[model samples]
Each structure stands twice: as C-alpha cells, then as structure tokens.
Target: MSLRSRTAGAVLALAVPFALAAVPADAAPVPEADPFVWTDLTPTYTATADYQYEPFAVTDGYRPIGRCAQGTGTGEGGAGYHYVNPAHVGSLDPAEPAGLLYETDSNGGRALVGVEWIVRADNAAGAPTLFGQSFQGPANLDGVGSVYTLHAWIWKDNPSGLFAPWNPTVTCP
Candidate 1:
C-alpha cells in the first residue's frame, strides 16, 4: 500500500479500540431528566429571586432532585452540589459558591415551580454566614416537550444592601 494509505489504516486501527472501550456495557451513565424539557415540570415562571413568597421563596428543609452530570449522585440533598451552571452567577467566595435550586409541578391551575439560592452573607448576629431563599411561581409550559426560557431574580445580601446580580435567568433551549 502507498505511504498515505498505510498511515491512515494504522491510525484507524489504533482509534477503533479506544472508541469502543469508551462505551461501557453495564455501568453506563444514566441521564437525569430535565424538567424544563420533559414537560413534566411546570413552566409558567422562568426563574426569579425576590423576598416575596413567589418562586424563590425562603423556606427551610426543602430540597429537589437534581444532577450535576451523568455518573454522579443525585442532588436531592446538599450532597451532589458539584453540578454547576458553567456560567458563574456572581463574584461570591469560591469555597462557598452560590447554589441554584429547582422545583417543578405539572398541574395547570397549581403553579409548581421554586428555586433556592444560597450565598455567603451576614446573619442576624452580623457574622459571615450562608443565607438562601426560594423564589417560586406557577409552572407555565409553552407547549408539551417544547423549549422555553427560565428566569430567576437573583441578588446579593451584603453590608451594602441587596443588589441584583448577573445572569439571573436560565433559558432552556
């Protein structure tokens, strides 16, 4: 065979096995369902952050099922917090990055969507601590299995006061 053809054949031979090895047979990663895409979750409110009792409402001891990526544990509690929004939300402490929580409901009349966010801030004692709240709203899906936009009203609670942060809404394409 010619030199070019011989080199091409050798390259394919090496790549074929590696590509096949990447696909696991039994232990394949399971993709977590996207409530936004699945139409199973409500979609009326995009995402917002406010002190009111709307979506992002502040309540204690409530968590949702989420995933950072495949092959990772479920983010039901605070255990699987490694899953990040690639897009950094604000200039918060790296060690205590902000959290983005999600909840959804499918019923039409009852709006079932809530988002919880946690950031480093001062508690009532005036000490550096973590505070978070849930912004909830009605889930209005545009269409079944259709793409829609998600928005959140995010802010910073520091000594200066509450400030609207960057990239508050998360759009689902």
Candidate 2:
C-alpha cells in the first residue's frame, strides 16, 4: 500500500471513536415499560353512576372534564375526552395517574385509550417529569386550573409518539 493511503486509513479509524463519543448517552432511545398495566384502577371501570359535576360523572374519584376534537394542522390530532381524578392531580406517581383518556365511538361508547399525569403549575417546584418524559405545560385547563400535564397512550397506539399530548387516531363525537 502507498504511504498516503496508509496514513489516511489510520486517521479514519481514530476519528470514528471520537465522533461516536461526542453523541450524548441520553440521546440513545431507551425502551420504556408499559404504563397501562394497573390492577388498582378496577373501581374506576365500574363506577359510572355517580355525578360530581353534572353530565360528567365521578367514577372512582374521576370526573369527565371534556372531549377534545382533532385540530386543524399537519399531525395536530387533538387529545380525547379527559376524566380527571382531583385527588391524584398533584401526585407524580406513575401508578396513580391524575386522569384517564377515552375515545368515543360512533355507537356512543367510550374506550379507554391512555392515562395522564398532572401537577398544578402553582403547586410545583419545577417542571414535573415521569417515565423519562417531561410534562408539557402550565397552560390553563378548564375547571382544573393551570397545570403541567403528560399523556401516555397506553391502550391505544399513537402515531405521534407515546408521550405526545395528541393522538391522530383518536376522534370525538
């Protein structure tokens, strides 16, 4: 081999390792645990008769907040109906989500799709994170007030991502 070619090959080998080391370790994609496997939420599935805010019933400490429709824009599918448990709002426990998300079918049936973890902005020391994902906002949520929220599309697959606030496949009546 020529001397020039040998030197070029040696340099390339040394550069490769340094280039790889520059990438952040956290940037690597990490596999996450399924967020939907909760046995403790059994009572929420059956408690649909009691009303806490009228029209919306309080089922196992959760009451229906509202349904959000798909927004106009590329990939801006809106979040579905939110059923919030007031008691769970401030806690960051992954097993105890602050709210449940449901998608309404044409037959007027609701299907469980995801879970939401919320912490009121005013009550938080900083942005709250769970499942390695940061909460989205301090935006004002009607009736619930300003809060930081994160959604995990557990039961349903989201095209956007697992932690995305909106799901394109979800629609409301």
Candidate 3:
C-alpha cells in the first residue's frame, strides 16, 4: 500500500475508538465514586420526634421502617434506621437508592450515614449492580423479602470497605 494510504488507515483506526467513546454533553454524568457526597439528605428525614418519626409528607418517597440495631451474634456493626422508598426498590440507578441509612446517638440525634440499593431476587433479571459494585444477597432481609442489597458508606467511613454490608462506625441508639 502507498505510504499516504497506510498513514491515513492508522489515523482512522485510532480516531474511531475515540469518536465512539465520546459522551454526549446532555448525557447523564457518570456517577461519582461517592454518590452520596452531593446528595442532600434533609428531605429524607421525618418532620417530628427527632429521627424517630416517619416523614410527614414522604416527599422523596422514602419512609422510616424502623431502626435496625446491631446484630447480637453477627459480629458486624448495625445498618441503623432504614428509610425505604418502595418505588425505587428494584431500580438500578445509583442516584436512586432504595434505602437511606441513619445512625442515632445517645441523645436521640440522627445522622445520615449511608445509602442502600436493594432488588428483590425474583424481580431481578440477574444480580443487579450499581456504582461498579455488585449487590450482596439473595438472602432474606427482615421486612423486605429475598433480595440483593448494596450499602455505600458515603457519610460514615467504613473500615471494611465502601460497599460493605455493615459499617463499624455505625450504631443504633
């Protein structure tokens, strides 16, 4: 082949992948490694009784199921209070987590610590993943049925790992 033709072919080969990889300006931005950093948890809280009350309006669609204390024999830290939004349960969107985790203090104060995404095993096409992490479980969670769950400890630092099921720093009451 001619030198000019060979050079053009090489250029085209390199350019094709870059062109294909370009993201559209309007495309939803890639999720942050810590998706909850910019997330405002104010709307997720209840209107009365500190963190003990269910949200008066349920604006974000999540309601407090109740606090989950540390397991007696599980040897893992607790997941704290769960504010679950039934509408987003099976969704794979990292931005729309199925549950929000909160830890309460000695004085009945509440703090948003993490987020959870859950998909009932029966409803999932396969195992679901978000933020490049796989969900953990087909096991039965208390109120929720058999499901896959992922926890992101964005607010509370987890020594175990970012997606670990339990955070050593998190506690109930």
lDDT of every model, 2 decimals: 0.25, 0.64, 0.62
Q: Predictions ranked by lDDT, top down?
A: 2, 3, 1
Instruction: Please report the candidate that would top TM-score against the real structure.
Output: 2
lDDT, candidate 2, 1-173, per-residue tens = 96544544554354334434433576544333222322222222222212212244343577777556465777677678888889888877765678877777666767667778889999637788776678998877767999999886655667676678889888756
| Decreasing TM-score order of the candidates | 2, 3, 1
lDDT of 3 by residue, 1-173 (tens): 96544544554454334333443466565443233422332222211112222342156577777557575645577888888788888877655678777787656755667778889999637678766677898867667788899886655666666678888777665
Span of ten consecutive residues with least summed lDDT in model 2: 45-54
The residue ranges of model 2 lying beyond 4 angstroms of the native Cα positions read 1-57
In candidate 3, stretches whose alpha carbon ends up further than 4 angstroms from where it belongs are: 1-58, 72-75
Worst 10 residues of 3 by lDDT: 42-51
> TM-score of the candidate numbered 2?
0.65
Overall local distance difference test of candidate 2: 0.64
Output the number of the lDDT-best candidate. 2
**Which is better, 1 or 2, measured by TM-score?**
2
Global lDDT for candidate 1? 0.25
